[model samples]
Target chain A: MNLALHDIRHNVSRFVLTAVGIGLLLMIVLGMSGIYRGLIDDALVVVDHIGADLWVVQRGTRGPFAEISRVPANLEHRLRAVPGVASARTFVSHNVQREHLGKPLRMNVLGLAWPEDKGEWVNLIAGRPLGQPHYEMIADASLGLPLGEKLALGKDTYTVVGITRGMVASSGDGIAFLTTRDSQAVQFDQSGEAIRLERAARVQRVRVNDVGRIQPSFIERGGGPSSSIPALASPMVSAITVRLSPGVDPAAVAAIIAAWPDVSVHTRDGQEQLLAYGMIDKARRQLGLFRVLLVVISTIIMALILYTLTLDKIHDIAMLKLMGARNTMIAGLILQQALLLGALGFGIAWYVGGFVFPKFPRRVLITPDDLWGLAGVVVLISVLSSLLGIWKAMRVEPNTVLS
Target chain B: MNPPPDNTPAIEVFALTKTYGSGNTEVVAMKDVSLRVAKGEVIALLGPSGAGKSTLLTAMGLINPPTSGRITIGGRPVLDGPKPLVDLRAFRRHHLGFVFQKANLIPFLNAVQNVQVALEINDVPARAARRRALELLDYLGVADRANNLPSALSGGQQQRVSVARALANDPNLILADEPTAALDSHRGRQVMELFRKVAHERGAGVIVVTHDQRSLDVFDRTLEMEDGQLKSSQKPD
Candidate 1:
């Protein structure tokens, strides 16, 4: 006659309802951990996939993810010339929002250095990688764009040549890969009114200047939009990603690059660390605090609930004591009920989370370690919470059964 | 029902005193109380409210230890004054049973489980304990209500299950405090008569502290208490 189980059987509805309430609280706790893990994974997804041995950004900046970074597009040539550097590709990314299917569609547009790097490393699940540079793009499946779908942006329409999955930026937006020149064109695209104003201002400045007066054709040549001048320098990229040759020491090459005054250099791991710790450190702390507060709240609620349950059984406890039941038996009754409640609640959270987590807008990634760690916490909370009930039970005098 | 031999007494308490609050506010709940009960005998302790009949009953049951004096059960000394000679809880589990004013059945447990728990707490094997619980409930004539929780059973039926639980360990001495207070006259007398039958047939010495005088004839002897002391003792006619 397991009294704990028998008692639960008698009040199963209330017990299960109580467990469900606790389960929902536990779900939030687990969800917090999962969301944090997903945040880190989302932050590092591009960094892990880029296959870069080193990153060269603007001097003293953490970028291209944690902060703004800009380097001359031709820096790729300089990086490739360095000893031990096998190849260098220009990296540029910026977020853009456009109306699609009457809903706001946001994406992080990443410029792939074409001819040398044509997004071949992207895990394409549908269609082919960029075959034509300017008018073709590879997009993450999360953008809800199917293969061959054409998206019009900045006076140009790009056909989706390929689709990938799980490729998202730190901001949780889907990523789209386009040629470096096309991306730069889109990033620096100006409205017709702004372009007209800029042209008028350049013409007025040329009329007022001595060089413009002496060489009137110079105004037409130099004042024209920079894109019309093919000999001018190229647009800036966010950073430069370098792949090291086999047997080349990344640290030695990085040290050499670090000596240059124009840019900062970082190993691949450093970029990941900067993204995880620098970009989302406050969010992590906030989530961790919420998790701690929730656990404490859960412990308090369970303690009060168990204490009330013990109070309800006061007379029965006295009767059992008078009937010569040992103190351990009485304590076991409360302790076992607490443990069972925790186990049932955790089971509910685990089972229901499987269905609920996928529906969240952001990924809720529950790892095996997270599951095991939460289970251990639940057990510890149950044991600690039952202490109030056990104390109350032990204080009940057996003579209370009299009269 | 097997009868025990007459020579050995089931329980004996000598000059037992129980008091509450130490200095200045001292209140004696039981004073200089001494009595003996033989096996196969049922005795009733009668008193008004606050007369300490319950105090004496609880003291004799080994639930509330007396402040002073001695207690012996089955010819073995168990308590000398307030101190215990043996492991009191272990001894009580094996040698004594108790019934309260209310059925006091653990509400979550069915009647049989309520009875079975008593045996289980004594380290009795579950199967054997369950079998004995069923037998005791059947003997008490509440076998049909074995699967029902206490709330679902009638008051008389609940008391019968309570009695069965007390007898589950086959204890030598049973103490009941106002066991029939919640039942009507007919049910009250029935519960009292059940106690008498339990005592005479099972050879257990039963002491019942009750306010109801109508069931006096069901006991082998009656003891009256007043102002925390035994005022009189008489064999029932």
Candidate 2:
């Protein structure tokens, strides 16, 4: 007669309430899994979208995301001149927090090598890609920057020409794209006071040196502009991204560049691996630990609940036993109830997670594999948890019904 | 209805003894108990609290094995001195029925389902078992409460359902341990009369243990137990 279902039907309110409590706990576990997946996805999103064949960073550095990397801007020209190199672009990225609409806005400012690559690969949902790269910017929708909105930073004011969706950096901050020079201007930006102090110090150095007296033009130009000076080198880039021509092997080109004294070269897959394992490994482990702990806690709670339920029906169990019910029949009652509880809880988690995940500050991506894996875990937990109740039931003596 | 011949015994227990503990803490709950009940006979086991009536009843019910004895039901030996002659559980499922003091219905199941489960335990097909359950409920005059859970029924109505469940498998022997303990005098007499009707109509041997002397007239014979022994047996006047 399906005694387990019959019992639940008799006490439906309590069963449903208990399932809801368990469902919420399961939701947190599911959310942890989703957040862990999201972390890896967020870390690799830019690397995948850039579609570079090779990355050339500063020598002896993992950069540009895992550590600091700075190569001269002219490295792009040098990379383009190499055999089998289809195209090369200077890559620059740095995080910036600026005030907009009386609130702090944080973003990863990424430089697009303009006139050659204008962020046409970005998943733009509104407006167009960077048409005029100087003062035009493509901002992610997460930054709350609408198309055509103007944002002032450093000495330049940029108008948002396009808005992208779900384009976040490894740190979970939205990205804003600008031309290489503008991004460099933002990266090395200094306050007027700091600039004046730096220029004065340069003039003083020139005055105190014997070479400055011999060459008066050096002192005069030192106060004019840092860029115009012959002694000062050009601004540096974070890395140089390279695209290889058809039938060209990236390893051969990378091996050639690896011998260079001033730069370290990496294939695209190598860069992605470094970013995933080297950057977000610890966070992934932490989330995995939390998920395991939660599953354990869930199993314990379900065990106690099933045990108490069996205790409540101890008399009924005795009567059934005296009536010659086999051990399997009684055990099936508890086991089926546990399975039903787990099934109900999982259904609730999946339904409610749909509404709750998108609202999280960071991306919560529940993949099909994660769903199937959690379902398997829940079934295993239900079976393990029902053991306590079944043990108690099997020990009930039929003579107790007489007493 | 015609009564079966005395030669046809539904159950026979020989020299049954049950004890608990050992040495200094040894306690005899029942000793050297022997009895025989014929088909179509309704008898009562009357005694005070702790008088070994329930001990003997449980032994006869095959739930608690005796320290020593032979128990045969429906002319087949089922237990000998705690050693089982056949599969005891299967024997109980097919050959015996029991009604406890409080009706002891599985609270979750409705009246008919409670009865249907007994037949199902004996491997009866569900559809036929349900039909038999409803027929038994109707015979006990509780068919209208077939869909009602135990809690929803009155005490008297629940007992009727319990009796209906006992008859579901058409068992040869039915045992009752103070089956009317929770009912009023009138309702208790009604339950006792229903047991008599079940015995006479179905030819099942019925043994009811009770402390109520008012329902003595409903049984054809009565046995009294005291200090773990059968002290007397008499046919009711």
Candidate 3:
């Protein structure tokens, strides 16, 4: 340490510059690690908040939440009959962009069943749950939705009923929950002119087909659109989120539901794996590539700088060896300098990285644990880099000093 | 502390032969060279260019082991048939000191620190090392520069620092390879007389390898080498 300190003192500016270079590289790696983690955390944030153990979607699709899952509203009655089912409900969900205070705000609207039971779906932060269900909405705190503010939803305006925290969706939009009926209305209601045009088009097509014959299907004196009951509604919907009764095995429940053969069920862990290795696999891979590149760049730069420093000290080393200094002492001097560089770099990186990341659009996460881990990496690479210089120093013949 | 003075030679070399390479490229730098130096003696080694004076000093210093030789320091077998009798680095640390042509002091250290480093390498305590380093610096008339870095000192003062460093551990023998080669005539003679003072007063065996013969009178004894062999050993004018 003494000789190492002396050498560093002799070359203070050069050593500090190397530390700064290493610190910048460390900051990059820390940012990459945080980004990969944030993606996974954000993707599952909505599902994790949903607090459901299983999902029930249309038999043929992983759909709805994962892909596209839809089932008849009446299926909730049949699902109630399944063994071990405490309760079953239907919900509709979709993504929409609406003008909020003259700014575009993306909102994830979820039509939850029995708004009073929303406890299982979201944690209310400020307002109360829906008392009457219609025209009321609860927005996530991230949406910047003020209490009692009216927001346009399709052709109608819905008032913000309550505010909630941590209700983000997989796509990072703030979530707003409404009653299932309202979500259904938002999805299916058409404009007046479009409805009138659709009716005229249908009448024209019918007249062309039957001419003077009585149009029996439209002959009934029924309310508008009642005559087209079957054709007017969309049959399939997004997947369903299911929560089982206490102690019911997810695997077994999934198997019982899979008896329909087309629907797929995933356990919690399996769902996480899907998100980690399947859905966001590309993002993770990208971050991994970036981390590797950063490490390689740092190693090359540090090795080159260290080798240059060694070249500059060749005479000093030859003199040391020729003066009868031991090989360990010389090697120790080099290795100590390397370790000190790592230590200084890590200290500066931790501070600079923390300050720079929150301002970025992506969350830059650097935990104390992460800083320690980066320290380990820096030390390992630094020590390895120093080996090249140590080897060169050792190879310098002390006999050179004589010449 | 000075031990009882003895007539035994401080260094002896017998049949010291050093060769490099083999077959058609064999080059013998030193062939069967034999020489000895007694205590309290300052010997000058003079030779032409490539005459192998450095090799002789390095071989005697144990920096370079001879291919074949028997060399003793203070009656201890140091080199036996070209092999060292003890750990080469430890032996050198305890018994041999070197003064190169340049001061070669560690740049970050002052004169005293430079000398202290040598004593510290021998495991001396810090307080004792500081006192002895100061004393040696004072003896060489550079006590005022003890706190000054080698770069801050004049060329002569830096040489004094190097001399103080060489005597830090009270070694039995001191090897100086062209110690005065980089100094002016006055500074060179001052350094030569310092070596004589260190030998006679401190009872050390000093061997200086140099081509300069103008200050040969400062040496108690002098030797000349030519073509890798010692030609004469006698008292100088």
Candidate 4:
């Protein structure tokens, strides 16, 4: 029989308890890596779903998701005018949090023109698509918004028309789709009280600067005294998503759009790169640190356990040495036990993670490659951890047995 | 048991000495201790608590390096002063056997496995090791308890298992320190007589350290120690 296994068999409960502790630590390491993957997946979901050949945004901006990007809503017409441009859709997006039955829920609200076949609504699991332009919304099923239910946003209440899966923002927020017009109203419409206050503030500004007051037309040009301030007007879109005709090169189309000094353009691959490197990079770093911390903790815990266990068997080690077992043999015994602990722990963690991660609130993606990679890391840790115990065991003088 | 081919003594220690600590704290545990044991002889080491009997035994076992000594076992020089002339661990595994005060059979292994491991370490195949282990256990009269762990055996039975393990490699010399100190007088004398039987029948030399003088009759010769030095030899009444 293997000496290490025989020793562990003699104290089954202690060995099992130590393995359980290491297993729980391994679970966290796996969970941290899974969270990083889930973050990346969630970040790219909208970009992948849009299926746009190119994204056209305001000059000097990354995109609607990574930075503030705005282009004239009418820019879609000009984009369609270009050769090889199959279609262009005006898209607006921003973050929003609303209450449902007293519980707060966050969503990535997207405003877009409908009837585009660019992979939009492709993952709908329930209800009908948004048939009309106003007061209708398609929500991700993760938002837990039931179809046919009314959800309030700003001044208007929108009825849920569809529910889809896997449509989440990089931050794990659900995505909600609405007609551009309704979204504009929700985003730009001012409440009556705010409008009244803003008009008073403007009047105060006109009176203080009396030069415009001397000419009634100049004042009228600005707006009549009680006239509502012409309502803050600007570009209505966060970006323009363009689909190219088949056989059209996205780089060629993007270059043509880039010549518009007022706008910047990116092909689909560029947007994906921007999402990966620009948007989700911070989350990856945090999760990477978390994984590193878990691994370091696991190493220390295993070392402590092995060292203590070795100490418990000090006399046995001395006897073995006295009986002519070489330093290599005794060290081998300790190293073998350490490795067994890691292997058993990994087995438990992998099996439990398979069942537990899916039930987590946020997506936890444990890939096959991750399992193989982590298993290698565990083996390395086992070897390194065994060193402390082996050193101690080797130092035990065989003469101690005589004492 | 077959007799060994050579006529050389099983153990020869020349002026062995062991001292602990340094300078102000220096105290000698053994001083210029010399001894020899021929094949098939059973010798008893009798001493007081601080008489350096253990130091001498440990030095002969090749575990405790002496301050100034030369040790030869089975006609091969094994140690010079505090340094080993050969790989001491390998030499011990191949040519020497040891039994301690406490049976000291590894608690995890059963009686048979305990003996098997000793042989296995000497490059014996596992199947052959097991068969030899069973035979040793039978020779030591513990064959029925071969599968029992050390914890399950009585003190005398455990010592018998330990003796079986010591003989597993057919070593030229066996050194046992207080092998029966924990047993009652009857069991102690039984263990002492067993050592005599092991020495004569197997043609191996045996030296046992003990405080029980009642069992001295079992040894072919007796050596006593006092004040870190050997006294005159004596024969049992």
Candidate 5:
């Protein structure tokens, strides 16, 4: 015969209606938090799968994520020569969007040199890894690309050699693998008209300058503006990923590379920090703001509901006071109702999030830790919201019944 | 009215005075009002509007304390001159009950649960409280409506349920403010008669403040008030 249970039994519909209202609000709260967690997970999946101990990028850049980092492809040779460095690979990556089967698909294309042993970076769910260069590609299954599907990037078309699962960028874009030469051509190749104009400009400048008594035949024999370009010298790569020898500390090897004036070095932890805190900072903050706003809205709604309920029961409160029920008892009645609503709402939201969040276009990772944390917040909000009702109930004068 | 064979009164108020505001705005709601009632006595307090009848009822119920008074209930002195001599809330819960002008039955609870809550608030076990609530409802002739909410009952039935609630703790005194004000004459007399039966059979003293004089015959004795002063009591023929 506790007053809270008794009252709720008497007004079962109202209690249930209020619980459901708060439940939907809680669902949004849980959903936003899960999306933030999912964003972090999506960002780290590629980094985790790469399994490299250290990343070597251009000087004064954070990494491939924060800014454009271009290091000479030849740096891989110099990196392999460092003590405790087992292997180094030239890795190039870029964001690309193209129409695939009439739908615009965003992908993060990753290019690596062959025989680098980095082909194991992707977990193949179907078909084999990328064995041939240039025309074969491995794509994440999230792109809905089946094995043997041909996709065109820029001017080159490649067949999907393998389908991997759960390989996506921080923005939830599917990942694709390309050969080094093909990716560079897709990224840096200029249009025919622009290349012709540049070539004519180079030849005209050479003929006008006439340095070293060069002849027109000499320039034409040198292959018509091709020899002047540094094609055979060295190619540019996004970054050099380094693997350390066994029993060697990555920080020690990274320190040795940091001394190179032409390049900057990042340990595995530093790159992860760049991805989590720097690359995704804005999106996380936006989601964080939304989460806070939802929580505030929920608290205000609960408080208003409890306050209105207390107002509606003012007469009953005075009667209880007249019946020799203390202020503490009335306060307990309101507080208990609030906590009950909070518990029920959290339960509903947790269940609903588990059931429906997977259908969202973006990954929404609702973890057990998030549930516990959100439950704690809901309880705290319930207790604080009940304060308004408790105040109203306590202030009700028993003398009002006599008047 | 005196107790049968027992000298101690269920309620005793000596020189009770209650005032509102102070200085130039001072209004005395009760002026030197004094009275006593013994166990099993059912008394009616009749007065016109602003005659301080409600003020005296509220003071006796331990809700609004008198500015100056010595009050005793169930042989225990609970208040002394504007200050409490004991825990007022506990003393009230243990010894007193009240019914208001409206049935004032908690609208959310059914008739039986409404009565049961009173005993539960006083720390009575739930099962025993339910049983006692049923007994009180039966005694008040509203047991048939025990499971119905207050809104489903008529005015007289609600008052009867409220009376049953007032008796839930086996209190020594029951104070009701215009319990029959909302009922028709026939239903009003029935509710008044219920108070009489409750007092005579349960051995609890009852005081009802009302303006309805048509049901006066049900009281063992009736007291009148005018200008915050008590008049001599009238006894039934």
Candidate 6:
């Protein structure tokens, strides 16, 4: 270390130039590692944020989070029957974009059961949670919409009653929650009027063409089981999120649930892997390739620089050997210089890499473990780089002194 | 030289031979050479190009290790029957100093650093090594160039740094292979005089292999090597 440090001091400019080149390459390695991590995080953001223990979806499907999952609404009742099962709820999520206060905001609208379910999916960052079964909405806080603002969804205009924080989906889009009935209506509200009248006529046994009369008979006024509102078409849900009690064996429970032909249940771990393996798998491989290429280029550059440095000192080395210096001593001198250069490059990369990230719109997270891992990598690279110089120095014959 | 030294010499070799290749194609570089130089004296080894002067110097330097014969330094047998009795590299480090044809200062290190690195290799403390290097540079009268890199110094100044480096280890014998071959006459004579002063004042046995006959007066004795054997040109005073 001492000899390497002295050599760097002897030729500061040459070493600093090599270090800068290595530092830039290292920044790319660190960035790729961070970007790879970010991609996985982004892909699983919704699953991770939903705080679900197990996700139930259609059979032969990895869904709700990774795929489109659908089951009959009564499937929740069946899931509750499983041993050690707590409660089950259904939600439907879809991407929506709208103008709020004159700026476009993209969002995911989740149809949730109200009263007992409002607090489960949405936590109020401001104002209040959903209080009404219809006509009230809670938006994501990042949407920047204030309470009492109105949002238009399909054919209905709903009032924003509250704001929720950190309710983003796997795509990093914020979410808004509405009542299950309202959600169902928004999802199908744009259907043909003739079809709606036909659906209503089938339920009421009257050829009523008026929208007002249909709502009075079917949507609003019916309290008795014999009322005129047509039953929802399949009234099926998008998917379900399940939370197991502590110490519950989730895999065992998932297996028991998967036995039903109409359902597929996945543990949280399985779902996370499915999302990474199925969705972000190719991206991780690309980043690995990028990291490997960067390292190869850096090694080539390091070898060239050290080789040049040794070539410049061949005569001096021959003289030293003739002066009775050992071959190991000369080798040590060159190797030490390479290690010192690597240390300098690592320091520069940490500084520049730390400062330059975060300005990127995508997250670039560098963990403490990640930085330490890279430090070890740099040390190994330095050792390998020294080989070129050592070989050159050792090949210098003492007869070169007489020459 | 010195009346054929009746006592055992500091450096001695007998019938030393070095041959490259064999059979149908062979080169007898140095054949049947014998010589001796005792302690605390200066000898000038003179020869023409390709006359095997360097081959003889390298053998005596213990680098090529003569194909056959015996060599001893400091009254202890170094080579016995073509096999070296002592570790050549360790023996070289602790007992010999060498000057080359060129100044050959390490380009990166300044003058004093070039000298101090020798002491450092032998595990001297940094402060003591620095002090010793500075003292040698001062004694060689190039102390002003102590902080200058070899590139900044002239040929004479660079050689002076090399000399300081050679003396830093304080070996018992010094070998100068064409040390003044690259310098002007004035610088060449001054370097030879410096070698003469070093041998006389420091009691180090110095042998300078040179082709420059102009600097013969600086040697206490002069000898000529032709066909790989030495004969006295001037008797020691």
Best by lDDT: 2
Docking class of 3: acceptable
Per-residue lDDT tens digits for candidate 1, residues A1-403, read: 6788988887899999999998998998999999989889999999999989999999999878978899998898999899999999999999999999899999999999888878988889998889976988999988999988999889899999999988999888999999998898889888988888887787787788997899898678666886775656678899999999999999999999999999999999999898888898998889999999999999999999999989989988988887778898899999999999999999999988999998888878899999999999999999999999999999998877654
RMSD of 1: 2.0
Give one digit per residue, the lDDT tens place, for model 2 in A42-122. Answer: 888999999999999999999798889999988989999899999999999999999999999999999999999899999
Best by DockQ: 2
Clashes of each: 1, 0, 14, 0, 0, 0
Residue A220 CA displacement from its true place in model 3, Å:
7.9
Clashes of 3: 14
- The residue-by-residue lDDT of candidate 5 on A1-403, one tens digit each, is 6778877887889989999999999999999999999999889887898878999999999988788999999999999999999889888888888888899988888886786653666888998877877788889988889999998877779899889987888879888888887777778767778778877776566667765145666445333445355543555899999999999998889889999999999988888998898889999999999999999999999999999988888888888887778888899889999999999999889888889898887889889899999999999999999999998888888777654
What is the fnat of model 5 with respect to the true interface contacts? 0.71
Clashing pairs in 5: none
Better of 3 and 5 by TM-score: 5
**Residue A167 C-alpha lDDT in model 6:** 65
lDDT of 5 at A364: 90
Q: Residue by residue across A234-344, what tens digits does model 6's lDDT show?
A: 566777778777788888888888887777888878889987777777878999899988877887788788888888778878767776678788888788777777788
Give me the candidate number with maximum TM-score: 2
Looking at model 4, residue A316 earns an lDDT score of: 84
**Cα lDDT for residue A23, candidate 4:** 91
The residue-by-residue lDDT of candidate 2 on B49-127, one tens digit each, is 8899988998899998899999999999999998988888888888899998899999999999999999988888889
Off by over 4 Å in 2: none
Question: For model 1, how many clashes?
Answer: 1
Write model 3 residue lDDT over A1-403, tens digit each, in one string: 2788887887799889889888888888888887777777766776677666776777655546566566777666666677876776675788888677789998888887764355344778888777666878889888888899898786778888789876766666778887777777777677888877776776665555663147556533222563455545554345556778999887888788778765666666666667667777887899999998998888888888778878878877887776667888888888888889878887777778878877765445566676777878888888988899999998998666666
Show model 1 residue runs off by greater than 4 Å.
Answer: A203-210, A228-232, B1-5, B22-24
Displacement of residue A80 (Cα, Å) in model 1 is 1.4
> Model 5 segments beyond 4 Å from truth?
A209-218, A221-234, B1-7
True-structure Cα RMSD, model 4: 3.6
